[model samples]
Target: MINMHYTACSLLKITFKSLLTFFAREEREDTMPNTEPKLYKLQKKDLVACILRVFAKLVLFSFHRITMEGLEHLPKEGPALLLPKHCTYGRDVALEAIALHRATGRYANFLMRAIASRFYEWAGGIKIARPKDVRRVPGARALNRASFEYIRWLYLQGEVLVAHPEGTRNPYDMGALKMGVIKHLMDVENEAGRCIPLVPIGIRYRGYWVPFSRIEVKIGEPVYADDFENIKHLLSYLREQISQLSGWVI
Candidate 1:
């Protein structure tokens, strides 16, 4: 019913990710004595993320022809925000994660759905409530505030953060950009008087979900809040840049 090679690859992938989670637990134990809140305690080095990056890189390399440009734009240190094109269902997430990690030598923090938070929190994921959750789920607003606080701490710590403006996977066409995270970042900047770079990362796949296909990622120069007159202009510029880089329009 299943091909042996496919099964083997699947198992290997699972093992690698599991190993990363295990190390995350170990790292947690070694951190400064838990006075800080659970999610905000920063490890000196994200060992789990480093290993996962290498593992993901190897796995991706074995299956795809990957190329990246404008890596120079990725900040060596952070307080950096990245907005990348969401292409494939799941593979693009791995591709972008590994690509950014290997290029910048830093693990990126991501804003993810509240439902998947526990599974990915150990690996730099910050859970944020989705729109539907806000309308229907109890305490969703409080959850959002907590998550935003964590994200603010991450920024203060100079951690790289990635949030897809499109909000969800859009195969080959760009979709409407969401402002939730961006607005939060703008607030953080205004309050803290800190200017963080907003880097647009565009990922294009030659064939969607096709093994051995070519993947091209273009990282554009970082844009800062000072560069835009207003949030509306900034959003429009980001959309334009991402679309141009990903070879997708609208």
Candidate 2:
């Protein structure tokens, strides 16, 4: 009788353990959320737009020789801020856009000047309005908010964004860094509740007005959003990095 009782107890314990294991698996599955969102699945229309943009860039610019370094640094997936120093004549802008597209299989969205909206629209690029113009249009405040929301949306969708913190191109003189890029980074982090990586790019031109004179692009390490306390520190660090890489004294 004692042996029978012991066998029954062992069986009961085994049954309880099996039940606990099943419930534990079910609970784990319920708690593990999907981190990746399916927002960036490119539609047929997006592909067409990318093709057109590529064609335009190829036809419009006469790139004599382009050397890209640190291509391996670009992330294979996910959204990132592509920040490059702005040079005179808008060459850096074109280079940034093309390089990003080539490195990552996605078209780049730029935070363009208000006046360039029509041109960007024609080229099938996303246009972000300037602060001054927000006052002119009806419901401008809402539009401004919406534009940023769209930026975050694009990021969530796994698209690349190239922004020049210096609102205007510098003439290779004093390294005057602006806060626009840092502001965008902070805004994105605030909305996403996670720090996005920043990719620093350096574009060097051998000579101005000399086509095919040799363009060198160096993509530096990624900077996390939480690395710096504020935008000032971030901008200062970026400016220094670009200056050092480009061999320019700021």
Candidate 3:
């Protein structure tokens, strides 16, 4: 009734050969470093970006009243992830990042779909391929590989990243938070670098489609990346925190 080979394999949790191969590949890719500068750093300044930032502020301040909490939770002297509940169809969700810059003087780079006629390279915003659909394009794999490196570099350099965990904006529920970002965060955490925070944010709006509306940004506790063994656990913690803060059910 006892097979020694089976016992050892079971103890090792190596049942699925395909899963093992996938994880092995992922682990190998995760530990490697990407040194490309263009992918990570902005080289030139764009005037249009300056105008847009100002315009965004004007609309945020003049058209809407913004309130925020949990200022103390932001990382004091290290890189951190600013995961916010994206207010779909409203530009005001970005006000949370702007607010971070105002409070700490650290610019938050948004991870967005590829944009042309956008801000300068120095605008601190990271642009990835469009549609953000990872499965349909051959170039998507390449883009994602480069982006992983760039994002890792950003966090190590004490930069703040503003990304939607839900991947795309959803006006209704928070939508399902994806695991890709969390996996990368785990990779970043295990490397030898400064500590960073994975922050969860919640945003609520009233009269959002109206010309002017009020928004409340609630910042919750930060989850240290190195503390989790798997991305699923990390994602669960994130969903719970965001749900608790925004009253949005998971």
Candidate 4:
């Protein structure tokens, strides 16, 4: 009789655990991000528009100057991840996109924070909630996973992906790098048995938010996932490279 009772209790516990696992998986599948969002298409007029935008920025801002260095470091044709320091809240995003397009002749897929803006949506930006905001934001973790999956798809397609690891714009000082993207890349590399190039870009502004701001973009040499023994080392190396290029102290 005691053996029968113990067996029943064990069965009940196993059933309960199985139900919990099932529900958790169902929830995960429901919250997974949709990876097939319409991406931006390049047009000949886009180049013209970029040129006009540069001209307008220079003419209106007057003292605004943009200098790009080490652009040749960007691969002419291949999959690369661009990690640029996020500085200004405005125009910096556009400037980086324009710079990448001009340098590589490719429209880069951006992994950015969640936004409802049409421009970002139209540009096919992959949106994920910040780490701190994930719990507060609904389905934030799933969205990040979906974004990573989309990025992997972009990688397999041999396209450039740009993600700002610093989370938010830091006008002067550098911010701590996030490991989520790096870890995701490592996982992908492991599964695919290949190394992905990670390009560090540093953008510095002398007078951010002012018309007299001097903007400089420095593109560092490509670092691969296999270059470092571990993710921490890779992150540290990336931070150092970016700090040097942006003229920001570690």
Candidate 5:
């Protein structure tokens, strides 16, 4: 619920401005080792960086005729959070982000795993340590902490973060959400100086993993920081909204 389509004329005046000022705000994480990846640290996204975001959005729009819903419900300015169901089979994360920016002019900062180089930098990408097993990846513990710290920083800075609460993509399953997401919202609000808005998003595609297929992006009404007292309530509401949005019932 709480969605609409913007007209062509409006996009010309509002799109660029929204994208320009978006994610151009604050974030600060605890002290970390210099050896940790840059993703763990909070760095300002400059004007040039935002400009690149514009271009990136355009490319995504041109790539597919994505259908976006409920964009207007998102805050026009300042910080917000989106927990989008991840659809790895359909490239939902990238495609939805692109569609979201095209429709609403809002961009999401993400926690990315460190590679030699990556494509996520366009969206204020932060390098993180991702290890399914601690034995498999060196320095994963500290790096994971750093990534969480930076995520908290992004929320504090007034940037909307797009995250997969399930922590991984399972296109057909909307499993248990990560407890960290719940705790993050509760723990960081006091330091943020404001209660951040937490929104739920759902992405559905015409055909799973089909090339050039039509996709629908559903953005549900926000669940604000103070709306519920604990994680269970927030979690239940989020799952319900996403289930309705994506039609992925558990």
Candidate 6:
């Protein structure tokens, strides 16, 4: 009976998503003007994207009942890097995006895996290659470079970029950290001549074996780039801090 209920809910979610996609496409088609307007018009696709993201947040919050702490530590203004622990498949990304938006009233540009780029492209996300696979594909290499360039532009434009330095979901166990976050910070520092504030976010899921388990997100104080000797040490310290705060042993 529980399995049947879970299956029914999953099917309902898929049906809703299909309906949203159909309407979004129809809205985009209907808004086309032959003359080409002077200013770009926002289409239904944009609205659909926002609505879909909100739907995701509602589902997550309903299931997990996330309680956020230290949200006040995030800067009210200026570009910053939000580094969160990777967990629970990809749900953490949605959790962080929604939480950050709620706190700052600014949408975060998440640095997502290249594989998820197509889905996120619709929602205005920047895709970065997993550092391990950066050397495998030529196109990925280009995309990685382009992704960094875009991130740099966004930072200068004063937007927050959320990155997961662990590179992949760690399944609640400690995993080796990647250097993409460090590299991006160093580049930004070189261009801006100062390190951007790095906010460490820790997400914990209660009862992974149970369906619709609770989630807790702890946002830590922003760590300034100048506090560490170099990018390596900075990332190491950030990892340790996040682990300590989240009660996850690294």
lDDT for residue 134 in candidate 2, whole number 0-100: 59
Query: 1-250 in candidate 2: lDDT tens per residue?
Result: 4444344434434543454354333322212122222233331244434644454355324433678888776766787887776775345666675676677665666766543323343333444445565566545455445556666787777666777766667657536776755687688778778767888888777765454466778888998868888777887888887776565776
User: What ranking of all candidate models by lDDT puts the best one first?
Assistant: 1, 4, 6, 3, 5, 2
Ranking by TM-score: 1, 6, 4, 3, 5, 2
lDDT tens digits, residue span 150-228, model 1: 8888888888888889988888589878988888888988888899999998999886445677889999999997888
lDDT, candidate 3, 8-111, per-residue tens = 32432332223334423332222213323355454324343344455557545655567888877876667788888876632533466566755675556677
lDDT of 5 by residue, 32-72 (tens): 22344354344534444456555545544544457788877
The predicted structure with the larger lDDT, 3 or 5, is 3
Error of 4 at 189 (Å): 1.4
| Leading candidate by TM-score | 1
Better of 2 and 4 by lDDT: 4
Which ranges in model 1 have alpha carbons more than 4 Å from their true place? Answer: 1-13, 16-40, 43-45, 117-119
Query: Candidate 1 — number of clashing residue pairs?
Result: 0
lDDT to native, each model:
0.75, 0.61, 0.63, 0.68, 0.62, 0.68
- List candidate 2 stretches off by more than 4 Å: 1-45, 56-63, 88-90, 117-119, 122-124, 131-142
Candidate 4: worst-modelled 10 consecutive residues by lDDT: 23-32
244 Cα displacement, candidate 6 (Å): 1.7
Question: Model 2 — which ten-residue stretch has the worst lDDT?
Answer: 27-36
- My TM-score estimates for the predictions, one after another, are 0.85, 0.69, 0.74, 0.75, 0.71, 0.81
